[model samples]
Target chain A: MNSLLVSLRVALATMLVCVGGYTAVILGVGVLTPDSAQGSLITRPDGTIIGSRLIAQKFDKPHYFWPRPSAPDYNASGAAGSNKSPTSADLTDRAKQTVERYGATQDKPLPADLAAASGGGLDPHITAHAALYQADRVAPARGVAREAIVALIERHTFSPGGPLTPDRLVNVLELNLALDRDFDPTSSSK
Target chain B: MTAMVFILLIVGGSALLSWPLGRYMKWAMDPDETAGPGRQKLDRIFASIAGTLGTEQQGWKRYMVALLIFNIVMFTVSFAFMALQQHLPLNPDEMKAVEGSLIFNTVASFTSNTNLQHYSGEASMSYLTQLCSLMWLQFVSAATGVAALAAMARGLAGRKMMGNFFVDVQRATFLVLLPISFVVATLFLFGGMPMTLQGSAHAATLEGLQQIIARGPVAAFVAIKQLGTNGGGFFGPNCTQPFENPTFWTNAVCMVAIILIPMASVWMFGRIIGRVRHAGVVFAVMLVFLLAKISGAVWFEQAPTQAFASLPIEQATGNLEGKELRFGAATVPLWAVLTTSTSNGSVGAMHDSLNPMTGLMPMIGMWLNATFGGVGVGMINMFIYIILAVFIAGMMVGRTPEYLNRRVEAREIKFAAVTLLAHAFFILVPTAVFAVTPWGAATLNNVGPHGFSEMLYEFSSAAANNGSGFEGLGDNTVPWNIATGIVMLLARFIPIILPLAIAGSLAAKKPTAQSAGTLGVEDVTFAAMLIATILVVGALTFFPAAALGPIVEHLKFMV
Candidate 1:
């Protein structure tokens, strides 16, 4: 009986320290870094909350760079991958359709990352190579030089230093926002 | 080339950190050791609190009872919080109460430190429950395992009494887990992981659509989730979620965090028993398995997924489906192996979308489980395998089995055998029953061998206290929740308690003087024996299931 009481006291005390104390400390520290603490929400010039720098947004228009295919249609609230098996016919059919949609020919193939769905469905970035592959469409649609669009992608390409880091990545939303800022694509195209 | 370098960095970085952290853990957990005035004050406070609760040195039976009772309290508290979460404060999203069986399953899951989630966190759980119930359980449950391990190590060291359970729990929580978690959580916050009580943020996209971007106190949750080997994510896709794991550096940090403590645990055990050389040999064997699995996973994932074989896309980048472009193909497979190997089952990519051979690597990790396994309990599991190896070697050499100068008689072997057998039994038996029933077959998101692999992986994860899943399994059903819940509970307590029992039995025996005939546990030959024992036992039990699932799937893909 004393053991049970001890167990209870131990559980409660541990909970207070771990859940209460630890969280309070982090939350307090979090206030100092408000931008990240509040989900890194990005705002427009007019101060409208546009999106997060981390989360992927849907972009199918020719003027903007598209992200990887999303199983949840880029639903941030319902993040998930397609979770398709390698041998599943449904998975194969979907991949084939994605390939067809990308208009990949023998000479000009889509990047594998572009043809595949991301794990979270809200993957914000694409490979720099994948972004470069779509330069022709984006450049024409935005009425910008192809070289300029490629240059924009290069400027946006990010690689956290080290051999362990993934290859250069370009955040699709950031590049599109940059396009709007420089080229005024919404006014120019639409 | 970069992939190989990445693997080496992660492994090497963890090994480097483990040594110093192991020494600190020894200092913190030791009853007689004090670092400074601060530690002495903290120790006095804990001692007084324990004194109020009757600070008697507990035997194995008493320790087990205290543990069971504490876990029951955890289960009850978590269940109440989850079930009544709708009525609780801090639920800014007004999330509803969880369903009956799911509540049971989740409570059992976190209480046992298995953390197998049947529901997505962003959609299903309230912030109150996430912090107060689930996250609370994550800390205490991991501390429970660490405390149990400390007691078991003391027993093996031939201490007349295992340390007081309450005091050990206090030390493990305050001294070890909390301090490390605070630092890691701070790092995660700086890496752009959200740490807020606010509801999911509303964002108007550039495409003029509303996206409810989920955010909460994730940085805090993820720190303990990885550090404690409790991989219950604050979001459904776990670390795959960008907000939870924002960048390559965060990805590297999470991967390193997953294995750091578990690696440190082997050295902690060595310090406890005063057997650093033996621990070094054991650590080397575990590292060998870990490197081998990492190599296999990375190699296998280099193949374009069979599903995309005929698609007119560049497959040279390897299986990119269900993988983040930011982390790429190499890091995902590495994370898969590391997470499973350590029983820290957070994923950077979907295991279900992995190439068959790649998927096999994680399964193999869970099957052998002791390749630098979960924080403290992993070392306990490895100890079970060591005893079995010792007994078999003893039989072969025509002498008595002894470890650390303690005789491993029939009782000890029986305890070890039961613990080993129970793990296989819990995993295989339910998988067999469920694979044929509506319970399992109805929930599968893939057909054929991949379908079977989902069920096998679920039970294996549950039984191994690994929470990572195929995720393709639509496993939020009542049957899955209930069945896996029971398996997690049994698998957790059996391995833990039985090892303690074995340690207790060994403690009662007089240390026999070592002779030339006695088996040397710290050398290469014993390493070979231990490796062989793990492979033979693990393979013998799970080979048929493996053949049916990933092996057959790989063959089919080849054809």
Candidate 2:
């Protein structure tokens, strides 16, 4: 019983120090860098919040670059992957449908990430190749030359700059926003 | 190619950092240190706060009692908090109280340092519950394991008493875990992870769709979640979530954080017992196994996903299903191996969508359960393997076994064997029961061998206290919650308690003088022996199950 009493005291003390003190410190320090601490939210010139730079937004329209397929439809309230095993028939059917949607064929296949659902369901970026693959569609819809779309993708493409860097990728949301600013699809030449 | 380089960087960077961190841990955990005036002041403050609890030196039995009682209190308090979350302060989203069984499971899971989540954090839990209850446990439970290891190391070093449990816990939390976590959390915040008390943000996307993006005290929660080997996520899909792990640099840092302290723990153990060379040998053995698993996972994932074979999409970039584009294929597999190897089960990619053979690598890590393992407990698990190795080697040479000048009798061997047996039994028996019954089959997200693998992986994770799962299993049901909750309890305490018992027993014996035939444990040959013992024991127990799941899945894919 004495041990139990001591245990209880220790537990409370530890919680106060950890949950109370430690969290207070982190939150306090977070005040200095409000932008990153507030989810790196992107805003319009009028200060209306659009989305986070880190988070994916749905972009099914032809004038925008598409992210990877999202199993939860980019629902941030609850994230999930398809959780399908490699041999599951559901996995195969979904992959095939994704390919068909992309107009992919044996002769001209889509980028792998373009045909797959991301684990988190909110992947913001797509491979540079995947972005370029959509150039034929995005350019026509925006009434811009294909070269202009290609050049825009190249400008937005970035790697973390190391031997350890993965493939250069473009943020789908950022690129599309830039497209609206630069190309102004509503005022198309066509 | 860049994937391999990143993996090597993570591994090599962790290994390099562990040395200095281990040295610091030695000074911080030592009870009798009169090192400096600064440390003396800190110790004095700790003593005043703890009163008798910090001052009293305990034997193994007393230490174990205090540890158990403390954990029980923590569990009870957190359970009540989670159960009544709707009424709690800071619940901005008006999250309801959790269901009874799930609350029990979540409490048990966190208390044991096995953070197997049945529910998604953003959807199910409020911010108050996430920080006060779950994140609090992440720090203390990890400290509990480290404290236990410290006690055992004291005993093995022939100290008169294991140091005070309360004191050690405080030191681990305040000195070791807190400082490191603060730096990591700040780094994560700058890397674009959110640290807000505001609920999910309402965003109007450029597509004019309303997107509810969840954000919370995630930076603080995730820092300890990785550093403590408590792999619970502030959101579902763990580090795969952009808010939790915002960039490739953050992902790489998370991978390093997962293994950093666990690797440091081996050096700390050696420091405690004054056996740094032996610790190096043990560290080497763990590194070899870890590297092999990493390589296997990376290599196996290079093959096109079998499910996509009939599709016209190009998979020449390797398996990309369930992988984030920024991290790409190689980093995902590398992260999977690293997470499982350290029992830090946070995933950058979904384990369910890994190629069949790549999926086997994490399982292999869990089955062994000692390749760097979980924080302090990893070293404790390795101690069991070392005991078994020493005994077998001694018996073959027609001599009694001795480790570090103390004899290893039947008492020690019996305890070690029971610990190992309990781990296997908890995993295999529960897996068998669940797989054949509605309890498992009804919950499967895949059919055939893959379904079996999911069940097997859950049990293996529970028993190893690994907490990573195949994620395809619908395991939030009563049976899974209750059974795995029970398994986590048993697997965690048994392995911990028995090792302490062995250490206590060894402490009682008088030390013998070192001789030429003291069984050189700090050499290449001993490492090989230790490796063989781990593999043979692990293979004998788990091979048939592996064959039934991933191996069969791989062969079927080939056909």
| Per-candidate local distance difference test | 0.89, 0.88
Q: Estimate the TM-score of every prediction.
A: 0.98, 0.98
Residues B1-559 of candidate 2 have per-residue lDDT tens digits of 6766777888999999999999888888874445688887777776666766767879999899888988898899889889989988998887887989999999999999989999999998999899888999999999998999899999999975998887788888889999999999988877778898998888899989999988899999999999999999999889888898888888878988999999999999999999999999999999999999988988888887777887787868887878887775678888888888887888899999898889999999888889999989999999999999999988888778899889999999999999999988998999999988999999999999999999999999988888888897999999999999999999989999999999999999999788877778899989999999999987578999999999999998755
Q: Encode model 1's per-residue lDDT on A135-188: one tens digit a residue.
A: 978888888789999999999998853555558889888999998888986565
Q: Give lDDT: candidate 1, residue B26.
A: 88
Two-chain DockQ for each candidate model? 0.76, 0.74
Locate the minimum summed-lDDT window of 10 residues in model 2 chain B. B26-35
With a 3 Å backbone cut-off (N, CA, C), the pairs that clash in candidate 1 are none
- Checking candidate 2 for backbone clashes, the offending pairs are none
- Tens-digit lDDT track for model 2 on A1-190? 8767777777778789889888888898899889989888999889888999889989887888888899999897888988888678898888777887778888888888887888899999998888999998889889989999999999999985345675889999899989999998677533
Q: Chain A only: TM-score of every candidate?
A: 0.93, 0.94
- Number of colliding residue pairs in each model: 0, 0
Q: Per-prediction fnat values?
A: 0.82, 0.76
